[model samples]
Target: MGGGGMGGGMGGGGMGGGGPPPDGLRLQYKAANTTADDIQIKPHFKIVNDTQDNVPLSDLTIRYWFTRDGGANFIYNCDFAPFNCIYTAGTFGAATGVKADMYVEISFMPDAGVLVTGDTTGEIQARLHTQNFTLVNQTSDYSFDPTKVDFEEWTKVTLYSKGVLVWGNEP
Candidate 1:
C-alpha cells in the first residue's frame, strides 16, 4: 500500500480549530496502491452537518486519477463518472465505520496489435465533492487498519468492453 499526502491546511480559528466557524469541510485523496495484482482505488469523503442549518448537496462531482509508471510523473484520469458509479455511505459522528461500494470501473487494452512485454503496474487516485454528497453528522471510524480487519471502503464495478488476454493472446 503506497501512501500519499494531503495538499491543503485548515483555516485558522475555524471549526477544525475550535469556536464558531462555518460547517464546511473538505478531505482529499492522499494514497496510492501499486502492487503486482490489479489495482483497486477507493475514495472517502466526510460531510458533517452539525448545525441546525440544513445542508444541500446538489450537483456534486467526484474525479479520480490513475497512473501506470511512478515518477515525476504523467497522470491519467479514470474513465468513470460519479453518477454512474457506486460509492460508500455511512452515518457516524466522529469515529464510525464506513461501508464500501463500487464507485468506478477501470479497463485497459493494448493498442491494436501491440503487445504488453512485461508485468505492468499502475496507481489510482480518487477525489470527493461536497456538491453531490452531504453529511448530517460527524463520521466516525472513517479510517481503518488494513492489517487488522477487512473494511469495505469501496466497490469495483466490472464493465465488459473487449476481449481479455489469455495465454498471451486475446480470448
Candidate 2:
C-alpha cells in the first residue's frame, strides 16, 4: 500500500522542486542612506519583471539579509511603496548563512496586484532599525550595499517566487 510515488514539494502537489519559476526577475537597489554605522539600514528596492508575461505580485517575496546586532525587537518599515505599502508586511527571522544570522522577509498580501511585463514595483523604501534606535552596523550585511547610491541591478538581495529563489545570489 506504500508506493511512495506522489510527493509534496516546493511548488506543491505532485511536482518536485527544480528551482525558481521561469519568469525572469531582477531586484534593483538604491541606498537612501549609505552610512553603515547609522541607526538605520535603508535598502531601497524595485522588482523588475524582465519577462514577456505578467507575474502576480502575490507569488513574490523579497528578502534583505542582515544581522540584528544582538538586538531584539528590531523594527521594519516601508517608508514608501507604489504597490501600496499597506499590502506589504515585513517579518524578521534567523537564517542560515554567512554575513547574516537574521533576515528581513518582505511579503505581500493576496491583493498586492500583478506585475506586468517590463514593469516594476517601484521604489520600495524599506527601513530596518533597532527598537531603541541604536546604531547598527550594516557594513557586513549580506544585502546592504553602500555603493548603490542610485538604482541599479543588485544581486546581493534574494527574491523568491512561490517559495523558490527566483532572483539574486543569497549570501
Candidate 3:
C-alpha cells in the first residue's frame, strides 16, 4: 500500500486515542487487514518529517501496541519497508494496561537512511504472528483501527525520536 504524510503544524483533537501531535516527525498508519480475527496482525507505517531538519532513521522507533492472546510468543515480519524490509526489526515487550499488555517495537537499521524536511519514509509494511498460530483479536488492540483503510495521522501507535516522544500516546 502507498503512504501519505502530515504537514507541519496541524492542530486537532487527539489522533486515534489521545494527545494532539507535536510538531516534528509524524507517524501515519493504516490497516491492510482489518478483520477482527486473523492468524497475523498487519500494521503498516510511514514516517513524515514535519520539522525543517533532517531526521535519521537510526534515531527513530515506532511502537505498535496490542494485547497478547494468552502466553503466545510472537514472530515479527517486515513484508515491505522502502529502505529494505529486512533491515527493520520488531521485538515485543511486556506491558501492563487495560487495552494493551504487549507492544511490538520497530527499529530501523542504518540502511533505512534519513528523512529530509517534508519528506516521508514511504511504506513500512509489517505484521506479526503467534508462534502457536493462534488468531489475533485485533479489534480490542490499543493501536488497531478497523475502520482506517488509508494512511492517516494516528496517535494510538507511538513514535519516538532518540527515545523522546514526538508523536502519539502510550496505552
Once fitted onto the true fold, the runs of candidate 3 whose alpha carbons sit more than 4 angstroms away are: 1-22
Model number with the top TM-score: 2
What's the count of clashing pairs in each model shown?
Answer: 10, 0, 0
lDDT of 3 at 167: 86
All candidates: TM-score? 0.22, 0.86, 0.85
For residues 134-156, could you state the per-residue lDDT of candidate 3 as single tens digits? Answer: 97789878999978789999999
Worst 10 residues of 2 by lDDT: 1-10
TM-score of 2: 0.86
Pairs that collide in candidate 1 are 60-132, 86-102, 95-140, 95-141, 96-140, 96-141, 100-152, 100-153, 101-155, 102-155
lDDT of 1: 0.22
lDDT of 2 by residue, 1-171 (tens): 111111213443212244447467888888888887889888889999997767767667888899877678888888998877888878777887889888888877657687888888888989889999987888878888888999998888888777778789887
Which stretches of model 1 miss by more than 4 angstroms?
1-22, 26-38, 59-171
Model 3: weakest 10-residue lDDT segment is: 1-10
* lDDT of predicted model 3: 0.79
CA shift at 36, candidate 3, in angstroms?
A: 0.1
What is the lDDT for 64 in model 3? 91
Give one digit per residue, the lDDT tens place, for model 1 in 1-171: 111111112332122242233222222232232122322323332222233332122111222222221122222233332322222211111111222221222222211111112211212233322232332111111221223222222211111111111111100
Ranking by TM-score: 2, 3, 1
C-alpha RMSD by candidate, in order = 20.9, 6.7, 8.6
